[model samples]
Each structure stands twice: as C-alpha cells, then as structure tokens.
Target: MAQARQLEQEQGQGSFVQSVKSELFSPEKRQGNLNIALSLSVFAGAIVFLRNFGELLAV
Candidate 1:
C-alpha cells in the first residue's frame, strides 16, 4: 500500500513538472513573456529619464 501511494505521488509530481515545463518553454508563452518584459523595461527607462530630466536641465 505504501509503495502504491508513493508511486501515485511520483506520477502527480511528474505531471506537475511537465505542465510547468510546457507553460514555460512553449513558444507562444515565451514570446508573450518577452514582450511583457520589453514593455516593462521601456516603461522603467522612461520613468528614470523623466525623473532625471531636471538634473539634465541643470547641467
């Protein structure tokens, strides 16, 4: 009984890992993530530039 329970647990874990891999490594998901990252980086850069604009004007 214990061995059966352990085997079931392993199967569950395997499926969980496989789902995670699919979600993370799928091409469409990867491209979406990349786009989100690029957009966030550009927004951060714009924020930094606006915050430092006064310093630039002073120089």
Candidate 2:
C-alpha cells in the first residue's frame, strides 16, 4: 500500500511539472516574458545612470 501511494504521488508530481513547463513556454507566455526582460533591462540601466550622475554631482 505504501509503495502504491508513493508511485501515485510521483506520477502526480510529474504531470504537475509538465503542465507548468507547457504554460511557461507557450507562445503567449514567451511574449510576456520578453516584455518583462526588456522592462527589467531598462529599469536597471536607468538606475545605473542615476547612480553615476549622483557620483558626478558629489565630485
């Protein structure tokens, strides 16, 4: 009985992982991921620029 329960749990986990993988890599999700990446890049760049500007002001 314990072995059967363990096997069932394993199969359930496998299906859950597959579902998550499918959702993550779907075309619609890819576009959203790209937008997120671009936004993060722009935000990081702005922060770096502001820090440099502040240092220059301090000097």
Number of the predicted model whose lDDT against the real structure is largest: 1
lDDT of 2 by residue, 1-59 (tens): 99999999999999999999887788879988789899999999989998878667675
Query: Which candidate number maximizes TM-score?
Result: 1
Give the CA lDDT, 0 to 100, for residue 32 in model 1: 82
> What TM-score does each of the candidates earn?
0.58, 0.54
**Poorest stretch of ten by lDDT in candidate 2:** 50-59
Q: Where does candidate 2 clash, by residue pair?
A: none
Candidate 2 lDDT (Cα, whole model)?
A: 0.90
| Model 1 misplaced regions, further than 4 Å | 38-59
- Each model's lDDT: 0.91, 0.90
Model 1 over residues 1-59: C-alpha lDDT tens digits?
99999999999999999999998788879998788889999999999988989577685
